[model samples]
Target: DAGVTQSPTHLIKTRGQQVTLRCSPKSGHDTVSWYQQALGQGPQFIFQYYEEEERQRGNFPDRFSGHQFPNYSSELNVNALLLGDSALYLCASSFWQGYQPQHFGDGTRLSIL
Candidate 1:
């Protein structure tokens, strides 16, 4: 079975630019979570989508937003990008039920030039 998959394995953008990262969850998964991992830092939760609605979000500012499709695929959008926004954006998926383990993708490496 395939795990989560992300597109545009690598990307580059300039400050004030906008970018969108895509993700396709593993089979049988219904929830998707987005995270941002900076160099030498742990993954920081960005937000989660379930039932096509944003269920939760982290401390990230409004510049970060996302969407979940009925097929359980997802997209993470970052607007007005900043140098600090350069990081590995991860996509994780799992059952929406309690205590299910999440499976993550290799992530998209975003560089702000």
Candidate 2:
């Protein structure tokens, strides 16, 4: 039983570029959520996907987007990246219920230069 997995554990990009990060959810999980964690700060919710549709969103800008595939894997995309976007991008998954605790993957550390 594998837990959630995220690829390209680290990334380097320049301003105005776009980047995509991938995630594979744990077994028996159906919902995927993206979060951004700045240095020394807690995670900030970006968005969530369930059943191939976006089910909830946070206060992030439209440049932040995500997709949930039929197999429960997910991807997070950021466009027009800014230097401030440098942070850890995390992917979390849980059962479709509202109160379930989410399981997180080792995040992708994104650095914008």
Could you tell me every candidate's TM-score relative to the true structure? 0.99, 0.98
Assess candidate 1 and give its TM-score to the true structure: 0.99
Per-residue CA lDDT of model 2 for 16-89, tens digit only, reads 99999999998999999999999999999999999999999999999998888999999999999999999999
Top candidate by TM-score: 1
Off by over 4 Å in 1: none
Residue lDDT tens for model 1, 1-113 = 98899998999999999999999999999999999999999999999999999999999999999999999999999999999999999999999999998999999999999
Candidate lDDT values, in order: 0.98, 0.95
Top model number, lDDT: 1
